[model samples]
Target chain A: MREIAAVFLSTVRMNFRDRRSLIFMILFPIVLTLILGTALSSVSGSSDTAEKLDSRAALINQDHGAMAGRMEKFFRSPEIRKIVHTKTYRSLSTAKADLKKQKLDAIIVINKGFTQAVENGSSKKLDFITSGDMESSLIKNITQSYLQRINAYRAAAAFAPQPAAPLLADHALSINGKIPRSSDYYAVTMLIMIILYASAYGLNVVREMNLSPIGYRIRSLPVRQINYLIGKTLGQLATVFLQIIVLVTFFKFIYHANFGSNLPFIFLVCFLLGFIIILLSIALALLFSYKMADTILDLAIPVATFLAGGYVKLSILDTNPIAVALNSWLPNAVAQNLVFQNIYGGTGQTAAGGVLKLTLIALAILLLTIAALRRNNHADLSK
Target chain B: MIIEVNDLIKRYKDFLAIDHLNLTIGDGELFGLLGPNGAGKTTLVNAILGLTAVDHGTINVFGEALSTSERAIKKQIGLVPQDIAVYPELTAQENVTLFGKLFGLRGEALRKGVADALEFTGLTDIRNKKPSQFSGGMKRRLNIACAIVHKPRLIIMDEPTVGIDPQSRNYILESVKKLNDMHCTVIYISHYMEEVASICTRIAIVDKGRIIAKGTQEELGRLIEDDQVVSVGVTAPDYSIIEKLKRLPAVKDATVDGHTIRIVLSERKLNAVLDTFLEEDLTITKIETNTPTLEDVFLTLTGRALREGAQ
Candidate 1:
């Protein structure tokens, strides 16, 4: 027991002593908490009390196709007008000026031949311009989301043997009755990215014990292999858990980011997310060479975050039912949804489900790590 | 006996690492396992430590068979690996204390062991400094300190002075002698014959997974006891003259190192060797006849230089 604790304490001390690792694992998060926290606070600070804010958007229809006319009418309809103050612009120059002056949150220009392309089963691009703020970016995604629905309906209409007389029928996607403030979305996304990057902790600590000469010395001692592995895993967990605490506290005190009424639950969700990331790093360490583990962690975390809708709200995974089914089970996606649900007043069922998925993944990775270590006994003994 | 190996055989695929080997090391004896690189010295050490499984053999350390309980047997042995195995990120004191705790030393015993280890290695002044901040010699010393911190009954050092300066090398040799003086049995493995001859009371020469010879320095030196080695220093010695000297009836081997020519021959051929230099008109600065060294014994038996494997 004492030997295990000594291994654990030594691993922790060694990780802390590595200045390069400290910069990425601890200091980088704190600095990001300061820069991103302060920058996002200005965008989210003004509208804290309300669940939704009225955003102003401009529409420019330059298409001569039948589908383009229908899309223009949908933006001017009463349903979109209630949430977005829409204005029709005659030219692109005026819309650009309003966006520059912050008068417009976003501007959507439906390109010519959009309807023709949809009719012929070809692709056409839409030009989107925003004020470069989080709110404006959300507005831009919303506009693009509506365009996606029109294309889907067009495809459905073409599939029917009997063409409907009214090709420009009205279609809508359901909203959850409450839209989260853009600031809350910003805070949650940042937290998700930070938690996933917790893989750095495992990459450093495990590789030190497994690959370095210190490892051989430890193996020659009376210590068991299981005790050594357990010590290393716990050391990384402590480091990542401590990071989550600092980030959550920073968001709370500095940005006044609301995590709903249940603060402990919010903290618990973040902790689970860190645990999952650390387990992933351990599994990765077992799979790849020590020199390649860090590089893999560096590339995998950011790419995972991007796919889980960390950079944009209501991403492709949100609208595509098939994508939604696949991504919902991913650790990053599950954690992302959990943070959004907890802060946006979601029912406890979704949050519980997300926690369950994360817990299952952590446990699975833990088992695989143990198996990999056991299988690696002969190779390690030779060294 | 502190360690006994009987008919040990270890094979990796088709290659045999240790083949049907037998040896015994008595307690409190500085027994040396001498061999060139890839001569199964390390393989034998690993087998004795229970780190590797043998195909058909048994090893007993401290009256306990290694195949039985490894952890219990390992507690009584200390290993100083060939490589410097100290953690670069850990301080000298932390490295020692951690290893000490591995042997069940706790509380005051752990602290005292760590202090004594540092003082013994002459690294107490840099106790708090990390190995990365240390010189190469200092890191080597730290490696020894970590191994002996637990004060095991049997200590196995495998080429502990491979790449350090002479000062640090001497320090390590001195420490090994002192440990043996405390009745700690040591198995010193090295490719350098001089180091083995200097400290080890009993030496075993291993080659090709087998012990070809084993005894004290004087007993082993007697392998070539009939041959005489004569050292002759000449000015601007020509290579052809040394070749001619080797062709003499009494000359068994001749080597030229700069201006010195060493000839191995019978004592009766000393006058004949000197006459060759005179006939060749080479100036002789010095001449001396000496006894055979361990290197000579090794060369005579193995037909290869001890340092050949190093290249």
Candidate 2:
């Protein structure tokens, strides 16, 4: 442990001394966030000027059930009223006609048997009719996400092991109608981009520790190889956390971006994401030679950025059967959504889901790294 | 014995790196492993350091077998590799301190050890300077300092002076002698014969992954004791004269350069070989007959110059 600590301190000191690369790692993300956010906001002008949706929406309550009435009440509440101007219409045909005539951006139809579907622990589909504009899709996603949470809780209750003990309570998050602004989304995406670049930094740290003569010197000492590797990893993690602290604080105070009321949770997600990035970097370094590992890290950042919606608001697997098959599970995408949902007050489950996903990735990468390191250790022994 | 290797063998893929090697170094001996490039000098050092596993052998260091007591054994040994192994980003002090810590030194002891190592290497005034800014000689000294900061019972230096100015090389050689005086066993590896001859108490000439000869300078020189080397400096030498000298019954080998012909013959045949050079009508400006040195011993054993790569 002492040897590990020594190596850790030494590696951290070296990283701090390398002022040029350190500056690049810390400054690049914040600058890109500002530039991208400003450019996106300008391109996507306000509703009045862009001829986009005006938040005027209509609702048709076909199921005269209690659940349907509750849904109607939610749409009419002042909380949702901030984002949506909704009017309950008697006829679905009239609401559809109004939506077509541009009087309403979208029409929400509470499907028949919606109340029974909720009470009987069955699924209910909410029909979201729209002209497929960005605002309409945003509203649909928000409403659908809320309903999905309710369904999840119901399913948990139904699957409870005992009669008296229930798994979850009937809970609905108060719709603040405060979606993440362009700055907030951009902040989170930029954060992902920055963290993904941690892989590059990680590769460099590992390369220095493994490929360089310094590594041979260390190996010749009493220090174990495992301790050396662990120390280097901790050093890289420290730098990443430092970058995160700077970027997060900058976004919070300077841009006034909302990361929910839970700052610790935001940090938790960031730390997990950082772990994933560092592990990936180490794993790649161990698996490939120096030049090949460098090539992979250089190529991975931009590709991961694009897939995680850093360049545009489109996921790599936006809509396809493979989306479900693959979980559209890019590490950066999971990281971006983890922050995006928390900032916008989406489902709380997203936090747990993100933790689970990142933890699994971390575990997998760690195992591969361990295997590679062991291979290297054995090979060295044979030398 | 500080280190003992019995019939050690190390193969890289299909090539033998350490072929059935056996060696024993007594305590406080400044042993030298002399070899040219690609002569498996580093490989032998790696085996002794336990950096490489042997195919078949038993290595006992500090009276304990390496296979079971690697860390404990490693704690008793220090390695100064041929390459400059100090971290370029770290100051001389930090580099020494880091290695010192790896050897389980801490607190006041580590501080004192690092300071002592820096002072010993004559780097006290520039301990805070990074090795990247250091001259080649200073870097070499810093490399030695890092290895000795832990103060192990035995220190192994591999080619510590491959490329450096004469001043630094002299300083390093003096430091090695100083280390031996301090009762630390030193294994100095190098290809330079004169450097080893000057300092090493015992020398081992390695080639093609095997020790070809091992002894003191006087002891190894005796390998060619029965033969005499006659160096003749001639003007406008002809290749036909060398061939004629080889035809002499007592001449073992004859080779000529632009104006000099070196002949190895039976000690009794020196007068006869000299007469043949005169018969070839060679203008002998200089004639010197001397006993064989380590280089001649190497050539007699391997039929190649000591400075040429075995590969």
Candidate 3:
């Protein structure tokens, strides 16, 4: 145990002392975050950005179930009235004509059996017939948020101490009908980017690791390889956490960056991503030579970061078909989207599902690292 | 036996690193592995440490099979590599403490071991200093301090004196002797003949991945009691006279370099070898007779290419 702790602490100290790693991991991300956030502050959403959505939306509820009636009541409530001015119509054709005439910003059609589908836990169709997706996505998120609250209310009402309401109107307004300011957007993405950069820590330690001269003295001790490896991973993981914490705290206090209220989930995503990168870089440095691993990292990290929209949101995956068709399941991309959705209350991507996906990636990288180390026995690591 | 190896063979593709070598070190023995670079000194050491896979060998450390009991065996052994392996970012005390802790020392034992290690290596005054702030000699001492912090039963020093000044080298060498005196078995590996001869109680001359000669310093000197080199400098070293000198019964082999005729011959029959030189049509410009040291015996045995007289 002492041996493992020693290795763990020593690895952390080594990583911190590695000037290049420190500059890239901690300092680079902070500076970039500040520059990108401040310069592009007005782009995402400025002072006039949070203006009312006021999208003239037509609500055509075809289902006679109480659930569909409740949806109608929600659209007429003051909460939805503050965002979308809803008008009721009996036929889809009439609403479609009004949408075509530019009289309505969107037409939301609740198909029949919506209540039955909810009760059966089956898929329910809620169509957003709007030409502009950017505007419709917010109203759609509000409607989806209402349905989720209904499901939760139903689940919780089975043993209710009191007959509580089916939904709280505030959740439907999670989007606040406005995208974040550039300062807020970059603040979150830059933190994610720093988590990705923590892979340098893994590369540095594994470069000296294994049975090489620099590591041979450590390996020569009585400790087992597994303990040494675990100690290494924990140390790198801790460094990543430290970097994230320091950056987040600095950005929070000094820059007043909008990290949203969901700090725990945001941090969870960062932690998992940090773990995957650390293990992945370890596998890279072990499977390949240090120089080769470094080259791969240098080539891969920035490209992946760009694809994940770390530098700037140049091409959104939803809008750009080519970007969406890339078929790469980038953990950073998933993490960013997950954080974005959780904060603004977008489509129903359960936090558990995203976390599990990141966890699976981490596990796979851990396995790869193990396999790499197995083959790396007797292989020179110092070079 | 502290460590015993039998029929160890290690091959790297086409090149053979350790060639069916064997070695044994007794308790409290200051054993020396003397070899030039690539002579398999490191390869053999790696095999013993279970770092390299051997094709055919059984290494027993502390009466336990090395392969089956590597961790247990390593727990009792400390290795000081040829290169300085201490972390440059860590302080002298931290480096020693980390190594000791890794070897299972804790609390008071850990603290004492670290302090003792620093004191033993004469680095107590700079315990808080990093390797970047230290001289090469200080770094070398720090390297040794890291290895023996746990006070292992056997300490393997692999050319620990290389690249350091004479004073530092002497200090390390004396430290090796003192460690052995404290009943810690020391494997002092080096290619420097004088250092090995002066310190190691039992020295093994390694060449071509084999122990060419291994014994007490006095015993190895006797291996060449009858061996002597006679150098005769001539104005014009005739290539023809070299063949004539070789024909003499006492002269084992003779060669001429520049303008000097060198003969490897028995000391008792030196006169016979010299008589031919007098008969030659050349005046003996200079003549010198020198007895062979253990290094000469090694060079003659291995027939390796030149290093002057160092190896």
Best by DockQ: 2
TM-score ranking of the models: 2, 3, 1
Among incorrect, acceptable, medium and high, the docking class of model 2 is: medium
| Residue-level lDDT tens digits of model 2 in A211-284 | 77777777787778888888888887887887788888888898776666777777877888888888887777
Worst 10 residues of 3 chain B by lDDT: B302-311
Deviation from native of the Cα of residue B217 in model 1, angstroms:
1.3
TM-score of chain B of each: 0.89, 0.93, 0.88
RMSD of 3: 7.0
Docking band of candidate 1 = acceptable
Looking at model 3 chain A, which ten-residue stretch has the lowest summed lDDT? A164-173
Q: Candidate 1, residues B1-311: lDDT per residue as tens digits? A: 99889999988778688889999999999999988898889989878876677888889998789657779878888899888887777899988887898887988888888998899999999999998898878888898898888788999999999888999889889999999999999999999899999999999999878998999998898877998888899988889987898789887777787899878884456878888999999999999888988877776677566777733
* Interface RMSD of every predicted model, in angstroms: 1.8, 1.7, 3.0
lDDT of the structure predicted as candidate 2: 0.77
Number of the predicted model whose TM-score against the real structure is largest: 2
lDDT tens digits by residue: candidate 1, A306-353: 667665543344435765665666777777767666665423235677
Docking class of predicted structure 3: acceptable
TM-score per candidate for chain A alone: 0.65, 0.74, 0.66
Candidate 2 per-residue lDDT over residues B144-187, each given as its tens digit: 99999878899999889979999999999999999999999999
Clashes of each: 0, 1, 0
Worst 10 residues of 2 chain A by lDDT: A165-174
Cα misplacement distance, residue B169 of candidate 2 (Å): 0.9
Per-prediction TM-score: 0.77, 0.82, 0.78
